[model samples]
Target: MRLLASSLLLLCLSAYSEGTVISKEPGESIHLTCSSEECPTYSNEYHYLYLYYTIDEEAEVVFSNIKSERFSPRGKYESRTKLDIHNRTITLSNLTASDTGIYKCVYKKSSTEKITCSVYAVFITEKTPCSTVSPAVEPSPVLMYIIFVCIISVLAMWILMLLILPKVQQRFIKRRAMHAHQSSADNVYEIMRREEGAQVAAPIGLV
Candidate 1:
């Protein structure tokens, strides 16, 4: 049993030895490189670079060079996937847990057995030691300036609104009261005119 397990482990390690291994956090972007001149894979004279993702030996092809003669690539990967045949590279952004798996890069001259080059790709999301991780990037001065300007604008607007809004509201209320009083006076004057007209016409009416 121990011998079998040891052999299996070694086999698994050997299975992933062909190409580069990358590790990244979720939602991060990654760029993968494939060389046509690279050893063993030789990978030369290919028209397109196809990326396959899987857990088993066989993988689900996720992205391909659309402009390739033999293949136009699949539709679902168009949003966050990109491939370059000239540079022999692939880039994927905004990765998720679903993306964590074995990825393979294949260079295809055509769909035929005449030429197909493949290399294994391994990725891990498990927490790596700090030494392996890239250093945290510092905020740029332009970004800091923009943030500072935004904060200042917000605080200035807030203070101006706080100081001026109440005075404007008070003035509005006074104008409304004045208009109401004018309306009431107009109504009273209309009634008085009516009463005076009635008294002058009848002379028998007491107002």
Candidate 2:
């Protein structure tokens, strides 16, 4: 019994020591393996695998074979995460600006046995046209001066119209009143001549 217990302890230690990592770029897949050289049954007991990513002082379990638990992701790593249990691989697809970081794999043999390994990954995202260069564009001095001159011209025209329009209207009204008074005086003189002709014709008829 004492020899059997010692053999079991050695088997467990050997199983924990066996781990391999495959490096991959962003938007690619990475495989992690935990197996034992001595015991075939111990190597096959891969119950679950947990994949974690860390960027900008934040760490999160992005993928896991055990699906019922809640996993929290920080920074811009809340999405674009996946895991495959049959092949022991984690795939981060459609990577973006925030996928550049260190990624780790944790293998869980059972409720108690666990092992971990980590690798560094980098993602080079394309920059926009505005962010790539510096020195912001400024409007030309000639354009600014032209705009100022246009505004001043428009204001001066408005002020001139406001000052001249009322005086012109008053002058036109006075001319119309003078013309009407002259027409009335001419009609009165014609009526007086007709009355004088009627009186002279009546005296000739009596004679």
Candidate 3:
């Protein structure tokens, strides 16, 4: 009995040596395969196949399947895993850093005898931080058109001011000259009237 138990333990330990390492980043998915070759009696007999993994060194059952029947995923793995009994595969999706551990596929023949058919060491890498500086984006055509319109409007206003200012100044100068000529003529007429009045007063004094 001791020899049989020791051989079974040795066989289970040997299964770990043939494990493959799967590396993935967060939010990604991975498929772990367990074909009939891994569990020889899988195709011949209708036994229970279980997907197990370690969490903090404790074994946790992820999925359980029996031949053609539907498999049930346990705990939080219910939403993250999909089991295909026909293909003998289990897919874990939306992976996170916490999912890094040793995953095992076991063939359970009896309550006392369980064989590890395949093993997988899953490693979820940490996400790299994004750069702080954003890439330079080209200005949109609508924005460029608005800027061009604003520049043209300012230039048109300046040109209108330059053309109108000289004409306004010329009109002001012509009005001032006419006002000065009228004032000079009025002053000359007043001086002549005063001189004639003075001459008439002197002749009356002599008479």
Clash count, one per candidate: 0, 0, 0
Once model 2 is optimally superposed onto the true structure by TM-score, how far is the C-alpha of residue 91 displaced, in angstroms? 1.7
Deviation from truth (RMSD, Å), model 3: 33.3
Cα lDDT tens digits, model 2, 1-207, are 323332332333223224332233345533333222321232556445556664334465454444343343344545655444444445555564344334556656777886665443432223326556654444335333433444555568677789787788889999999999999999999999999999989989999
For TM-score, the strongest prediction is 3
What's each prediction's TM-score? 0.42, 0.34, 0.51
Of the candidates numbered 2 and 3, which has the greater TM-score value? 3
Off by over 4 Å in 2: 1-46, 56-58, 66-79, 110-112, 127-207
TM-score of 2: 0.34
Off by over 4 Å in 3: 1-18, 130-207
lDDT of 3 by residue, 41-122 (tens): 6555637778888633556656465655668888778888887767778899999856766688877767777777678767
Q: Give candidate 1's TM-score.
A: 0.42
Give the alpha-carbon lDDT of every model: 0.56, 0.49, 0.68
Q: How far out, in Å, is residue 42 in model 3?
A: 3.3
User: Who wins the lDDT comparison?
Assistant: 3
Instruction: Residues 1-207, candidate 1: write the lDDT tens digits.
Output: 323332333334334445545656677878766554541243345545566775434554554443542333344445776655556566778776446445666655677733334455444342336567555544435334433544555668678889888899999999999999999999999999999898788855544
Error of 3 at 25 (Å): 0.6
